[model samples]
Target: MIQATELRLGNYVNLNDGSEHDKIRQISGIEHKIVYTLIKGCRFAQVHQSFDRIYPIPLTEEIIIKCGFERSEYNDYRHPILFGTLTLYEGVAELHISDMYSVWVNNLHQLQNLYFALTGEELEVKI
Candidate 1:
């Protein structure tokens, strides 16, 4: 479950709807601690969801690639801002800068927050 307070307008998260795979949605709004997601409709409609059905996506190598980072020589995912490595040991994502300053993140939103804090920009992500 994700806290509405921790999410931003553009954060990507998975919304469970009893399907085999959770549906990824970009946050559109938050009110009364309830998250509103943009869903498919004419021009995309907004739907309010409970925290119980909303979850933070686990950070992974594939997700890193999806966010436009390329693989570095060290096999870590690299973008203009930093390089990241996700360990198989519990979906932990470690992002390190050129000076080797590292920050560990458990989900994609946390990574997004960290990136925005450092770069003052939102990630150009598709999902």
Candidate 2:
């Protein structure tokens, strides 16, 4: 199950019980209450607030075909992205350092620091 907080505008989910008609709804935000429009049939729509009640619908090829999503619309050139990589080294975990290609970390403190630098969110590390 995917949490509501993790949902993005393009994510699909099942907003109702797992019935045949309840399986493929896209997360259209217009309804504000977490609305989901059906990927099949006449575009049936449903809304719910209890995100826990929803199950994220996986985007299988069949579902994509059913949804009529043109492959060209999902092209990388149409939606450019900037990305980075982070790596961790277990021994002598002390300092955090970075170069143009990657970030290297030696310990838990360094790991948390790198995570914060990249995501702007404090990461809770668990041993």
Angstrom error of the Cα, residue 110, model 2: value is 28
Which candidate wins on lDDT?
Answer: 1
Runs of candidate 2 with Cα error greater than 4 angstroms are: 18-21, 30-46, 64-127
TM per candidate comes to 0.84, 0.33
lDDT of 1 by residue, 59-81 (tens): 87778778777776554667765
Q: Compared with the true structure, what per-residue lDDT tens digits does model 2 show for residues 59-122?
A: 2333323322223323211101113322212232212232435443332334334445666664
Best by TM-score: 1
Q: Report the number of clashing residue pairs per model.
A: 0, 2
lDDT score for candidate 1 against the true structure: 0.77
TM-score between candidate 1 and the true structure = 0.84
Model 2 collision count: 2
